[model samples]
Target chain A: MTDLSGKRILVVEDEFLVALEAASMLAEVGATVVGPAYHPAPALQFAKTEALDAAVLDINLGTGTSESIADTLKSRGIPFIFATGYGQLAGVDPDAVVIDKPYSQAQIVAALRHVLA
Target chain B: MAVVPQKDETRALLGLTDRLYRAQGLDDVYAAALDAIAVMLDCARASILLFDDQGAMGFVAWRNLSDEYRSQVSGHSPWQRGETQAEPIFVRDVRDTGEPDWLKAALAREGIVALGFVPLMANGVVVGKFMTYFGDPHDFSAHHRELAVAIARQVGFSLERHAAEKARSEAVRDLKESGDRFRLMSEDAPIMIWIADSQGKCLHLNRMLRNFWGVPDEVGDFDFTSTLHDDDRAAVGAAMAAALRDRQSVTVKGRYRRSDGAWRVLETTARPNFSASGAFMGMIGVNVDITEREEADAHKQLLINELNHRVKNTLAVVQSVARQTFRRDGTGDLEVEAFQGRLAALAQAHNLLAAEAWQSASLEEVARRSLNGDADVRIAIRGPRVELRPKQAVTTAMALHELYTNAVKHGALRSSEGRVELSWLTAEAPRGSLVVRWLERSPQPILPPVRRGFGSTMIEQALGADLNAEVEMDFQRSGLVCTIVAQLADTVRQ
Candidate 1:
């Protein structure tokens, strides 16, 4: 682990439990967890106001609208990783770290470290 | 019967015998002549056997026995040509006859024969054999027997008259059976068949008509118009009425109430039956039961519609999965198979869904699709009707298929000793939604995978998003427990 403590991490997940898990992971390393929003509008709004060190986005937002939030995060020079069921976001964000669905704690941490490095 | 011949009636030249011969046709001539000869001979039976050019003798009439015996004994009498006899040859005890095989066999089969073969000659030329049979063995009387020879002379005078009448009657009977042949074939056919006169009054009905309608045999005597169902009777009656009024043909498929009180579907074709005189008499038709075939056709159409819906949903899933999966690295047979495997899983799920007519599938069905294994599967589906949309059905099918494939690659189900127990339960959610748990359990030891693959992502994320459920899988040291909170309202389309 790269000791992502004190890092302000923005969580953008549609599922409450998954959001809890992401926030728990960031909190374990002493970082701040900003969001577990089901829809993209609140997530994008939260990203605009909050100082985000990084972001975790659930690829399937309500009404398939995750990219608008992804664009918002990119504008702020924040790094993000996509957690998705369908592997359908190739051309949209090829450079971002992608954590496939059903990720283990170790794999999620390792992938985030690579993205932040 | 004793005959008293009057001397005075005899004095009138046999009482207008000349006038009787002139007025009576030749058949009456043979009858009158044979009666007069019977009186002189005092024989019990006297018959005329006219010989044809083929030399076969035929009994034309009889005086002693009734017409019945005469017909039986003298049927196409077998007298050959060149067997000329100046005197009558008496056949006594003909039952013990010599075998030209047919002659002796025929006599033995009939059980009686006492023939008197009398050949009539004209100017030393043999014309035909005049034959008679006696009921008892009696010597021919000199005066009476001489009268039989004279009777034979009168037959020669009227042989042509007898032959022409016999041929005419035979031709009429042949034509009648020919007409009835068509009637017999259509009536006996398995399909319901019947005929009605131009008035639409049923005239003939075959056994099939009664059988298909479950009617008794006597139903043929009743009117067919009475048996039709109430809704169909009016239209069927109208078509029949139009056909009869126009003297044209009619074909109809209608419902009729059977004798068992069930309505049956019958397809009928009716055409005008005309007489030899060209008079339109009736119509004949056949009806067949098409109920089973119609039901099969309807089921097939529903399947086609269901298939179209599945295709559209599967394409959407593929479009999303392909774009995301290929984003990382879009090359190789491995990725393609992975993609195709997802689609195939979806297809297999659809197959099961289609089997159930798009109704809710058991968790076992989903599990069976998800895993590839040599293990026995036990399914426990406990819930109300949770009918899946085409999208839901496909996604579930594919997820299970991928799970099964992974299991086959590495799990308890991969070995012969293992079995998978797939169970589902619906629990009340906090927001009034429903939580459904799909748990795959086994007796063998297991461990969670070090790395989650594409299969895991599809099952955990895609299905979660679509179903609005949180899926948690804990790979226990003993087995696996996947707790899924599924909102019923999210899974089912409104």
Candidate 2:
């Protein structure tokens, strides 16, 4: 396993339990887990102010999409990946890595490595 | 003196022939006949009569006869209709013997003492008669009788020709009228209508079709395929060509550019046209605009996609909750992993169902996915193509997951040399019954567990209840063998 120690990763998800699960998974991988933001508002705020190595975003956040956070992360020259449950990717940057919902730990880790590389 | 009169009659007959030939109508022919009769027969008055539809004679053309005198003599016939080869009659004097006194009185009142009746022949049958009236008593010689017959022949031939011409012209007029009516109806129709020639060149386009293509209302061949969308052009052309080659009916759908620069989906149904004598004339087609219907279908597909996305997200949330509730410390890690594996198998089944819009899924796919680790090397899957309903597929997938994990932990898969074989097939005896077998073998003997666990319970109890299946799990020293048998209903077998 690749060590991500001291690397800060932000987890943004609408579902509380899902967000907490993703955060703990990142912490187990030796990375510093940032805000497990449950909505687009805090997710956007954290995206605008936080210094991050990478971001894992859920494309749909109940009220609206997390596209604004993705856009801010792009402007800040940060790499990110969109994890969605829609079966297919749509209306997003073509370069962004997309993973389906209920992703395994190995899939998430591999995707993080590819985006950060 | 006899030869001089005979020459005059011959000349008169020739002159009559010229006039009859140039006559424009039946009325002109009747006039010529009346004039020839008066001149050649040496009579001051003559009248032409023909048979009406009721078989009675009526005066059609006359000269120098009073209306009362003509009406009194009407219906006078010396020969019946359809009597062939009849000779003309000579009533040298109406005042002679063997005559009714009333007819004699009427003839005398009009100052007619002599009359000659000549029969007109058509198609070798008597059709009508012509009469000559003289003011004084006279005798008709053989020359006078022969002259009258010649004149009757000319008039008979002309009447027969006129009848034939009239029937022909009426048929032509009726045909033209029907054609005009068809054009009027086609132009006013709501759908686009077109007619093509045998060579596939469009010969006619109704008003709706012309407006659809923004073409002028002129009679010229138009290439209807020019306005078809690029992607649909080749396909539509090929279909039409095939239909034309075989002279068959065809239906094709494509996108066409309308006059307003918008694309509209159109479905055209066309049939081959034939003439009365069974000759291939061309094709006639009707086009219906279906853009609205196609758009509605696409919108429905989008809605189904959104719904599937929501369901997957809910499944993801459930997985997260299960993980949070189960402690991840060493003692509880195995339980958490087991729960997650079961959830993943269910999600995999859901994915398969969703791909097919939740209709059905194949058994081979469920087995391949559930037998996850070293499946290609250590396991053999053999089955005919079998399909199951949504509920049956989910249960079957869960059962396979349990069986696979159990073999890996405590069954045949725990030994390096162990192998597994799975097979399924349908039966005809029970009318669509299904049978599946799973056999595991290892060099080391396997033992039956003392206590049942969740995996065995799921495979044996839940699966059996959900599918109405009869399942048997046999633990032997050499391996473990599991068999399941179930009936497939017609509604769920796909």
Output the TM-score of candidate 1: 0.29
**Candidate 1 docking class:** incorrect
lDDT of 1 by residue, B108-200 (tens): 454435666666554344556555556555455554455566666655544444445556667667766765786677767877787677777
In angstroms, give how far residue B472 of model 1 lies from its true place.
1.1
TM-score of chain A of each: 0.87, 0.93
Query: Which candidate achieves the best DockQ against the true structure?
Result: 2
For candidate 2, write residues B73-189 as lDDT tens digits: 788787888899788878777766678887788888889888888888887888888888888777887777888888888988888878778888998798778867777889989
Fnat for model 2 comes to 0.57
For model 1, how does the per-residue alpha-carbon lDDT over A67-107 read when each residue is reduced to its tens digit? Answer: 88888888888888876544322234577677644443455
